[model samples]
Target: MLDFFTIFSKGGIVLWYFQGTSQIFTQSVNSLIKSVILQERTGSNQFTHEALTLKYKLDNEFELIYVVAYQKILQLSYVDKFLDAIQLEFRNKYKDDLQNSALSSNFDFRQDFDRILFEVEHAAKKQIQKGKVMKSFEESEKSKKSVKSMIENKKEEPPKKSGKGKENKPVKKTPVKEQEVKKTSSVPMATSNTSNGELDEETIRKNRERLFGPAKKKKSAADVSKSPKSPDNNKKRVKVGTKWVLGGTSEDAKELDYTDGTADNLDVNGVGVSLKDEELDYVGRMKGELRDVETESESEEEEEEETVTQKTSSKKSSGGMFSMFKNLVGSKMLTEEDVAPVLDKFREHLVSKNVAADIALKLCESVSAKLEGKVLGTFSSINSTVKTALTESLVQILSPRRRVDILRDAMDSKQKKQPYCITFCGVNGVGKSTNLAKICFWLIENGFRVLIAACDTFRAGAVEQLRTHTRKLNALHPAERHGGQQMVQLYEKGYGKDAAGIAMEAINFARDCHIDIVLVDTAGRMQDNEPLMRALAKLIKVNQPDLVLFVGEALVGNEAVDQLTKFNQALADHSNMTNPRLIDGIILTKFDTIDDKVGAAISMTYTTGQPIVFVGTGQTYTDLRNLNAKAVVHALLK
Candidate 1:
């Protein structure tokens, strides 16, 4: 039995829904929309959330999605057929409403739904019964006559003659030897007769000459390989030598210049400050390109304009189902052959943009599966339709499951007198600390006090780096402005301390100090480092930050998937929880460096099913930006 059925528009408008149970399915439906539909993962037909399993069908032309949810334990066999039948019936009944997306909430299809469901279930049951039913007596018979009549009519073939081997055995021929070869094989053998069937004197001489290489063409490899060079073949051996003697050069100090008073260069009286070991090992702040700062008004205007263009494009693309492919001359169904070429080219485009090869292949397969056997409109082309679908899919991939409002969340945490903790972790040199500072700066810019925990105790100058960033951020918003409370502060216990304990202590310190957010900077380690991974897992499990952001580089291609996958696996394994906590989100650093090769974004998102929480586009504190799914996809395809 179905627990829920719903039809919704791509723009988040629910047209009609049927609920068969009192249990609220809002969370399940929302999750389906967020984790599956919005993620452009329609490539998969089924989604499992807790106890329910959801199956969905997408109507690209109508920009609609039909979903059905049921208990996972039930082995419902008719969901697919039922979905297809309902889709047809609904489309036929409300073709105009769907085409226009009007009366979306005004449709009444309870009767149609119930009738279709019942018919589907009945057909399924009948199919099962038919398979189990036994055949009648006459139906199982090869002959329709009575047993006595069949016995009388039955006949056997007469035995064949036993003298076959004695008289009719095939006569084996002694092969005709060269006589047949001369007649069949066109390639003249070296010792075979000429066209006259005889080896003449002139032919023999010519054959002998041809057997070896021509004199002018140089000796044959066989001759050279078998014959060694003799002394007479070489000119007089001339030994040419210039600066070297047969014997080694004499060991002498004649050219030595150590006689000069080297003590004249040394001055013991000159005094200077002695640098400490820490000073000698200090690393200066990193530098890179920064994103151009955008004014609040300008950003809002751009967002509004982008939204308008997107809406217009979507409306134009699928306003009327038939209008889509109207330019294709006539309506025709798509086959594997029709879309294969386009999907191949699309896959190459994704790969060139640094998408993983396997991921690209699968994406092409998904597109092919969706387009196969589907009718194209008279107005469209295969390339264009495939591109449109691919674009939509990519946009869904980049779209986050939820609107991540860090500022709002931090504000809430501040109200509750608890620090909002965001921990940054990733492979080494991925700009984790830098991006942490960028986020910290953003938090401070919004008037919230931030504490950066230097939990990267393994690496030298890790604490100092955060300290420098804290100072810079505080300078940008000095303490004189917020009642003498510094906007940004760094909490550190120096190097060689337990990172996990440091993080826990930092959180409590922030809570006590009234800090709005604590950005914990964990040491970067390769995904394969078990000890470090265990340490990282312990930090997350112990402190349990509100958000665990994995920092990854955008420049990576196929390695992106492996790195993120391993990191997540390590966390889950090391955390040792029944439902272990994996990477909650991603911080994609060096976004600007990747150009159009934005496939790492897709790889990371696909691997973890998490969002790109922040993209570090530049070096400055203000260079961070939220991912724009459409813009990213556009760049990717381009």
Candidate 2:
């Protein structure tokens, strides 16, 4: 049974919904399904949420149609058929209403859909039951047929005949007419014998030969032993005019006399017949024809070579003229009209790669500004020129303005007798705790003391997760260290406590212990959650971390832009400072999953004006890699 079903307009407005389960659960499911559909719409049209067993479909008009089930259902065909029927009926009934936007408020579908809902439900139930029965019956029939075939084969094996002086008589073959009559009869036939109650191989062979035609004859031993004719015996040698003629000793050979040499002038029906003397004449003519062919081929080759040289020279002259013109102008400039077409294509490409439409437009505009009146020297074509401009622009935007040197900053803080506090924040499932652990590992590997502050009191296992990471990292002590094994310390105030207060306490403890850096792990919060955002802003305001880096997934595309923007705004507003605390840098997670849709990294950085310091390539601690602008641009373009 369907747990929930929903219909959405092309613009993602929910037009109708029916829930057969808890309202809260259905709402959550609907939100998740909407997010999945939105993401799919950017790249694909259909996707399945395996966790919820929800199936979604988008019609030709871009209307979203979806259904949810309690568990995995094998008979999905019924659901598809039902959805098609509903969509057709709705479109047919509300053809004018759907087209006119002003009619949406007045249109009521509740009463009209009752019949359709009932019919679809009944039809789906009957189809599902019918499918199950047919599947079971087919299995039973297959098993029965297999068992009967095996028993029949065992019973058909003839028993060995006893060796006796009396020979067994051949089985009598049934007439074709009687065989047809027996086949039409209802009585069961015995498997041990034919209709005549006897089994014989000779009789079977004779009957088969009678029904079909006779076979080919086999070769005799004498015919197979005969040898082929020798070359010397097949021809007679005769000398004529300084050449010897090998003439065949057959009826066709008697027409020619080899000794006279008259065969040279002989024309057999205007076709050249080569005799001993005519062979020389034929050779001479062949040599003349070969020479003509060689001359023609050589002339053709020379002409092709000349054409290639002319083309190369023409290209060089054109290139030189262009270079001279640039030198005269004092610089190569890209006019607005020159790159409009190329920029349009590039914008489309970015959008097709799942980059946000607005961001893509802005990126194109930025590229256009950067390219206009810019020097172009030795560039090949408009395509390469635009590519170079875009690559440089992306690299400029992606390059971090403020360098993130964690070890250097921590060391400087250590020398000053204070712990450098760094806080990690982002929405849920962006790997906040995991990335904090990775940074901790990096600091320790560089021979610096690290402390993990478990200030994420909201999540149930947030503190435990930090403790696990600390335990695993503490085990990997560098062998070159002169002192005892360096271990990471975790400070947790347990769940349901003031997170900002705990972070402040952890900072004080780190200062007392002379720790190099204190990595604060904040609870994952959604950007749209005002309460949580305000709480996060309070934590940041109270603690005032040296580095507040935003961690986001690279597969979220433009949504990451919205998230970072809202997060930055919240922090700026609630921090209660004249100049709001800004995100120092971004740490993008899941960089390996989104193969072609990697524009998220560029979009996030370009939108926030923040650099991506490190990208999490995999789940392991060692999977983190320093971000390079060229490498990122290459991956995106590739």
Candidate 3:
């Protein structure tokens, strides 16, 4: 049973309160609950306060807090059902009052609160009864199974033997046991013919017949243990189709004619003592004739070489081997076809890193054009050359024209006595509010007075979410409380209000209060949403925020480019400016979620020509870090 239930607007304003029987709410207890509600927007739904357990349920416009005090633990499902029912009823009954801030001022919902509680109690009781019936049915089914097993055990028992001297009669076994015995034994079991189950001669004879065949003789253990003898040497070996030749045979040696020794002494360089004078004269005469013939041949060869060279020169001019080879391979100039393989592979590498296909192709093409015809060093291969080129190109693209000097801007705003207004824009679930709070924390740490504006009226709990951040920030760095001025303020007007007007008002308030920086968190809107985009443009135009940083997820790859482009175009058109109202920079959130596919950071910067100012590394406010180009490029390449 609920101890008490309270309904409050998202802004922490109590709308109605109901006290259960024997339940009392002191001032301190009420303050504690309100403090918890203000601090936590989306956390564990239950917390302990004193002796009671406070369970909370949140909706678009209001939050329902139920105080549950019980001796035994209760099911959360029941509590949830009750809370859901009451929340629906209250919202329906007070829709007008909830939407209109004017009516909510004097609205008293205690009258309808009792009726809503009664309906919820009745419905909860019915569900509890249904649960009990299901549990009882399950218990009864278990009991039936236990009783049936006992009866089966009794039926399977056999009667004991009457006398020890009398021949024991075999009892009939159950079919289940019989099947088990049959599966284990290869031979069939013999049954007794007598009704008393006495084994007779015929049963014994049949059992013996089943154990051993009638004609065949069984071998002894000695015969089974002896090994078989080897085959006789004279036995013919099996003749496979292909003959196996082990060593050289005499027939192969005889085919080589080893007996021939006549040519051994016929050496051309050996001296021979013969009738040499006439032979020497003949040799000398032959030598003189050979020399005359050689002279004529040399003259003819020289004339033929000169004629061939002249004919070749007349046909085509002779060029150096290196120049001719270059012309053949076209090494002086490089074409797309020349480096197509390298570019294709590099493009694939970029795509695998989550870079978009077209963007990857463009990067590859740019690299290829720069690398064409360039002589590669001895240590550098095509892959290394391409990687170096890509890294340089990426660094150039990621290097923004102007760096975001947040601290300097804040200081300037402080000097001018006007708050440096920054509006955060992004798609849904890109951590706009969270990053806004992170920036606020950064400003506060830098000794600048920061104020948060919750102008995100579109999303449920958007304002509450920002408020939660501000509460944490204030708790971490408490205000001085001098002259009743807060160091950090969260300005929210609840849901269903003009977000642009709310932002403008917040800015005006910030300016008057001499705040250093005002971080305006806008509702996460898609780039294609025309009306929302126009509204955002109006918000920016009316306030002319000093910095409009686009928050995007690093895991979105090249899609972040398209989103920022469309957003910039929309803002430019709505502002009616010649040049588009460009985003000052990007704040990439969830950077840690994308491990290796960090190419989105490169792609976003490359496509938008904007630098990433800061990155949200984790859930904490301190996780925000400045973006380093070299580290990012190294991470991508590595």
Candidate 4:
């Protein structure tokens, strides 16, 4: 039996021979299982799991041939629609076994499908409830119709039940007649109340009419009716010709259609009044429309206020001005010189004006930092090199005609021209950085790509200070710190002493990048420092920059000329100097600080061959004036 059950699990051809009670039978059941699982059936797998079995008994001289046939069976959830008698044939034949298998089956059909079944059942119940309610409504309507028909029949055959219901009918008729009389009497009261409530101004006229009966020649319809009792009253009623008016009258002006007007007396007793339907409709529609508009407008205003509040909160919590100030101070390109004293003054002024210390500090720092980094930076002068260049070597290039032609050429060459690389050489506090920035601005304005190299890396704020000018001029600064592995390492590498070599490396970098102009701001040293001068001269030789600008403070006095001569001489005689070219131009800064004009004139005298290209009048970037011999003469002559 178990061997036959294995075949029933899935159908296959079974060759079986039972030897005895514990004998085993072997058959090729693989083909049967594969065939049954793949076969197409009428009701699909939902009806029943039916596996066909083919059995044969092998018999030669040693074996007898016998055959047994059965169906493999299993329990499964079936579609109710497919649970027909024909589909249940296998279950009927093996009813006891199949029922036991179904009871023991591990499949949890209800657990998985209960929700969907419940939803479908709920929807069906709701639809049935709706149908029942509709049917009830129809029955009630039918009952109402039946009651109406019975009432009509009673009216037609009043004699049939008249005697039996006579007393009850009289009671109903008496109340009905009294109700009609009461209703008639209350109409006048309602009209009077309406008149009083609506038209207080018309009270006097109304009171006079009410106090007296109808005039003999103008008796009302009510008066005429009462006159039927007396012929004299009838005569009076005929003379009065009774009349009644149903509408109100007012003495005060009333607003109608947004205009002030005396209301027309609506003579209900007569037929002269008229009304327009469109006007009433328009007024009603407009009232509702205006209410809706008002509601929407109020909602919009609330939303706007909330949005503004959110924006204000965001600005407040964002650390606004303070964060901005910090960023400005922390930038890679600003120094003490870049940030001026005016910033502190402004902060103090804000505090004096009753602004909070923290707030004022934040605002002032932000404004000053932006000014230093952008507005101030662009116009701020670390040095005034533009005036120096323009007043000297570039003067011949400044003719209006020449400038105009160059302007045109510059516009065209702007796409092709290589930027110039130059260096400013001078002692400390000579306004080298300030002048270099001013020249950078001039070049940028003239459509030149200018870059500044802060080779004077020894000063604490030297790099930052140089960056301040580049920031002000709004020029591109490609190199930040070039200490190691740089083509030009401005600082010393290890134990090496290669200042000239470092400068050459920087020059090579500029060459490789094809930078338009390289302005190397050399470290401030004494004009008589021969070793430094030699190093600088060697750098100049290697870089071969277009021009060398000499920056000196106007406060240097007569010693300024000597300083100039010394540096110029060194530049001219550095090494096997064939062409004795010394300093190309002179930049005199801080003239505004100098009280003596003679000092400036004497300094100019030292640069006999070299022209004074620029003069610093004040501390501002724009304060440096283009040095004209005539302007110097005026300031000195004055």
C-alpha root-mean-square deviation, each candidate: 14.0, 32.0, 36.6, 44.8
lDDT of 3 by residue, 260-323 (tens): 5543442211212122343223211211101100112557758988998897565554554443
- Over 149-232, each residue of candidate 2 has an lDDT whose tens digit, in order, gives 666566666655658755566688664443553476554322334565554566556554555545768867655555453244
Q: How many Å off is the CA of 285 in candidate 3?
A: 99
Q: Which stretches of candidate 3 lie over 4 Å from their true place?
A: 1-334, 481-485
Model 1, 534-609: lDDT tens digits are 9999999999898889999999989989898898899889998988778889988898777677889888888788
Best by TM-score: 1
TM-scores for all predictions: 0.60, 0.48, 0.47, 0.32
Off by over 4 Å in 4: 1-418, 471-499, 595-598
**Which candidate leads the pack in lDDT?**
1
Error of 4 at 593 (Å): 1.8
Model 1, position 421, has a per-residue lDDT of: 92
- Model 4, span 1-638: residue lDDT tens: 21231112212222222222232223333333222222211111221113433432212111112233234452212212112321133334444643354423333233323343344446656766777764565557666675656564545644434666653443342212323433655333212334223423354354445555445588788887677564554244435655545323342223223433322432211122232453223211211101100112558758888998998678767976554343222223434355556556544543443334443454434333223322223333422221221223212211111111223433443345543546688887778878776555445434345456666756677765654444333312122222221112122222223545555665566556644455677778787788888877776776676567788776654466567777777877885567755676666777666553423433333333455555666554445455554344323322
C-alpha lDDT score of every prediction, in listed order: 0.78, 0.68, 0.68, 0.45
Q: How are the candidates ranked when ordered by TM-score, highest leading?
A: 1, 2, 3, 4
In model 1, what lDDT does residue 607 have? 78
Q: Output the TM-score of candidate 1.
A: 0.60
**Backbone clashes under 3 angstroms, per model:** 9, 0, 0, 31
Q: Candidate 3 clashing pairs?
A: none
